[model samples]
Target: MATLPYWRLSGFYLFYFALLGATAPFLALYFHHLGFSSARIGELVAIPMLMRCVAPNLWGWLADYTGQRLLIVRVGALCTLFSFALIFVSKSYAWLALVMALHAFFWHAVLPQFEVITFAHLREQPERYSQIRLWGSVGFILTVVILGRVFEGLSLDVYPVTLVVVMAAIVLCSLWVPNAQPSSGNRKVLADGFFKQLRSPGVLAFYACVALMQMSHGPYYTFLTLHLESLGYSRGMIGLLWALGVVAEVLMFMAMRRILLRFSVRRVLLFSFLTAGVRWLLLGSFAEHFWLLLLAQLMHAATFGSFHAAAMTFVQRSFGPGQQGQGQALYATLAGVGGAAGALYAGYAWNTLGPTITFSMASVAALAAAVIIATRLQEDRP
Candidate 1:
């Protein structure tokens, strides 16, 4: 019973992302267990994100205006816990969608603003942001691999219970996390959307690029585990493979400060997108080749790690403290819209086009992201 002292910012991220690790990779499989079709699963899974389009901003606005950041996180987590409690009743799509929408509406609210919280704390030493964030990867990998093994002989009904526990942890962490509030802190409503800040050509281009790269991940998130299962990989292996991707992400985060010092955020994103295009292409073309598949997992550092870290940096630098909450909200909204579309489309395309063709589209989308960066994104000297 020793109290955990919050340091720099990494401890919170470890718990925060560990929650994500417990869920995102496994939710699809959980839906798969509900006797739902892939398409139905996509819809169910995407509902929370789909709701994120508006929910996070609404919550972010409240946080920015009220200066009640911790309360917002607590409320979001409580709603998440309460919303999921009804999930056992979700034997059908309508019921599931309703529950999902409710939970997601709240769940999405916490992160966008909390990301701002993390960044706010890291204002002086931004490089250490990843050192803390890497714990989230650790949490994610731990959950995926352990849960994968646990699920090999078990059924999928356990997803909700596991999710609730993870979410509760997030809430607990938020309650204990102390962020310094600036004396000048006050939020003013802009009549227009953050789209104004995005009026800059480079900013717009960067946003579009992120949207594309996230969109390309649709197929991989929706069908990768099932596809691997069809290829005869066990649940345990799938979890570890998923864990491997996080491991790479964690490694990338540890080295992120050094990397950022040397390269521009735009350059990192461009490289990540290009690597994603190639990674999905290879996975689709040679999924049955295990070693090749592992190599593709290694590329996850580019697709997710570098790409995400760069995107966060861009967001952090793009807007000042006044717009921090909304800034994070905008990224969540865009990712939600793009990621939901990708996951949904990939689900439908999955059985018909097959992983080969489906993942080819992923490559195409990621490549398009790279092209957008080349044409639209121009960064000043860092």
Candidate 2:
């Protein structure tokens, strides 16, 4: 196979995340169409994401040990394609849950390893990292908008097939992706242990802050569609709004190199965490204004994009080749644990307190996250 272009790296990012954009916005609605109850949908959606806690770390270790991260990515993409395509085979809650778990099990293997691949290439230069990964945001937005428009005509019945098609494309791209050349780190160094790594003040603090941010997002992802649907927005509009957020995310990724140059990653993380609080509060308080909603979507740049990029940069700087796998695993673990808890609580909150109160809860979570970062997270320069 020919060497992959730099843009092709971006292409892979775009396609994978575009698959996310295609599904995340509409899956709840699809479950609704299939007669699943609201709480059930929330639980179902959370299951796949929640599985990230265990799956990624296991796969990350496999890649590091075998030096076969690209092969894992290919396997994950193919499994995702197959498992997602089987979504139509059964509609029972148990069966759907099983399918989602299997898909997520395979799906979760791609990201952390891919992060390793990107960093392995750009270890000496992180600026290019965002440029490649930013294509993911582009893919996400483009897919969301097109599908949003498509769903305007078709009923939600097409959700399964559409997701399958996109996921299969991701697999095909994975097949063509160029593999990473392994690094020659100290092969004998093994005593560093996960706890010792966590003892690093910077890593611990960063993980804490990230966990909080992920926690804050729980309600929005769990019930945002249901919340809006209850408020009378059509499915297409919801998808468009989702696309709008990704557009903001794309812009931020494009600008991330400049931002990092000017600002410390810790500082950026702090600001993003703070902004998330404000964003969630505004979303809770101002649900009716279309313009306000659009503006809030734009805040996704800081809330998720900047925050995520900062975290990734921090990982790359803090960990060595020997520790890279474990570093990424820890990040995924904290995110998964934090995200799952946040999403579960949000589901409960939405079930109990309704949208305004549930979203207010999310805002509170964001604020708590900001405080954790600001208080525990320290930066020498910023």
Candidate 3:
């Protein structure tokens, strides 16, 4: 039996999500600082997500074929750092778009493979998955909270430097994590007919639902800070609001085992979609109310926290061991597609439809996802 390198795994997630922390709250703000229109900002931001649709699946296939996941992770992390470094050369929309495309192509490849590696280490104890994964929430909170103040004190031009530091950390952590072996003899069986399992109705519905869930997050990820700024909130407050949502996510991760024990994954997923719908509706209707906004942020416990936990477990169980990388990659792919669509629409809608209508569309997406899961997905009980 292998001892789980608890902190090693945790450290990787911490640094990895820390990069997200920097991007999610401030990247759009950075582009805004450059005086780009909302649509251009959306296009810039969407570059990475658009790459996610193809990058992870291609990398996952290679990892499965070669069984060298850690090697792939390290190379991907290193390339991401190099690509992102190009931002210093030029800040033009064309230049930044090129950099974002290259950076995200490599960066997005790191996570889904690492997810399989994490579960590989956990082996028979999948319940411990969230405990290990919660460090990512911790990483996000620290970055959002600190960078919030940092941006307030300094200029948004400093954002890229901060991201570079985090990217370096990711590269270092990738080097530190050891390669995990595939499950015993499961690879051969899994390799034989992986795509056959992918054709199931439940699997199809689950990916569709996953896409919608991520699509609904577009406005939040792409423009929440700007929206709050428009509503008279400080930069620090916007950061705290972002941290608050992840704090809710952290708490949910801590209690995920208990939650899973009591409810079926289908039940949990249905609840997550419904709660996400409410969250979007509240944000669209009452974003000017700080208290209401806080309440809506708390729904992150379900929107991302429970939804992600349930969805990851569902993917793990749905496929055999050899196919886990692809399972996780498929999740990333659909999420990329959804996120890209959401960000694109949110960009166009932010100026024309306004935040209320923009986010209302997100609410409708989540509700529609709920309908899909309720009708098409079955409870995965073993």
Best by TM-score: 3
Candidates sorted on lDDT, descending: 3, 2, 1
As a whole number from 0 to 100, the lDDT of residue 42 in candidate 2 is 71
Alpha-carbon runs more than 4 Å astray in model 3: 184-192
Candidate 2 lDDT: 0.80
Model 2 ranges off by over 4 Å = 1-4, 187-195, 380-382
My TM-score estimates for the predictions, one after another, are 0.94, 0.95, 0.98
Any runs in candidate 1 off by more than 4 Å, and if so which? 1-8, 182-195
For model 2, how does the per-residue alpha-carbon lDDT over 1-382 read when each residue is reduced to its tens digit?
Answer: 2343576578789888988787677777778788977677778878877898899889877777778888998988898888876778888899999998899999989888888887777657766678888899989888878888888898878778888888888888887767774364544452254456678776787887777788788877767777777778886888888988988988898899999988988789888988888888777778678888888899999998899898898887777676677678778878877777876777666766777787777788778877877777777452
Clashes, model 1 = 2
- Computed on alpha carbons, the lDDT of every model, listed in order, comes to 0.79, 0.80, 0.92
Which pairs clash in the backbone of model 3?
none
Give the per-residue lDDT digits (tens) of candidate 3, residues 1-382. 8889999999999999999999999999999999999999999888899998999999998988788889989999999999999999999999999999999999988999999999999999887899989999999999999999998999888888999999999999988898795664555577665788888768899999999999999999999999999999999999999999999999999999898888899999999999999999999989898799999999999999999999999998888888888888989999999999999999999999999999999999999999999999987663
Candidate 3 TM-score, true structure as reference = 0.98
Residue 313, candidate 3: alpha-carbon lDDT = 91
Root-mean-square deviation of every model: 2.8, 2.1, 1.2
Query: Which ten contiguous residues of candidate 1 have the minimum total lDDT?
Result: 182-191
